[model samples]
Target: MDPAAEAARRLEADPSMLLCGPLSVLHAVLDVVVRAYGEAAETVRAALDRLEDRVLAALACRPHRGHPLPGARGP
Candidate 1:
């Protein structure tokens, strides 16, 4: 089963836990949201790092390399 579904099932098994009032519920949801945001930011950072490494490698290996790379000139 999916992890989200499993979490939902666990929550459903204890419906009373949902009665912890608005503040508690709001905190729980915000905690999850913040954690997910952090995970996403890390994923994006890793991807961008990889892209930067690749671009640097390509530039270093290019023959007749010049400053300011292709298409980087100001209008």
Candidate 2:
């Protein structure tokens, strides 16, 4: 059941227990939001790890040549 609807049902069932029902609903929603954020963080972390690995591999395959600055003395 939807969180809002469930909370409404609780409120309607007992009008006097005002704070308790709504607080429970709020807690449930926050829990879902937090979990979603955690999943997103993990996804971004994996993507960055893959990008770093690809970049390092590409750099390793290239031959190193020191390019002297223009008009500067070369050894």
Q: Which residue ranges in model 2 land beyond 4 Å of their true spot?
A: 1-19, 68-73
lDDT of each: 0.70, 0.74
TM-score, candidate number 1: 0.57
The candidate that achieves the highest lDDT relative to the unseen native structure: 2
RMSD of each: 6.8, 5.7
Model 1: CA > 4 A from native: 1-20, 64-75
Give the count of colliding residue pairs in each prediction: 0, 0
Model 2, 1-75: lDDT tens digits are: 354565567556766656666676676556656666798899999999999999999999999998988899977
Q: Model 2 Cα displacement at 59 (Å)?
A: 0.6
Per-residue lDDT over 1-75 for candidate 1, one digit per residue giving the tens place of the 0 to 100 score: 344554455457767757776654555556566777898899999999999999999988979744686779755
Give the local distance difference test score of model 2: 0.74
**C-alpha displacement of 1 in model 1, angstroms?**
12
Error of 2 at 37 (Å): 1.4
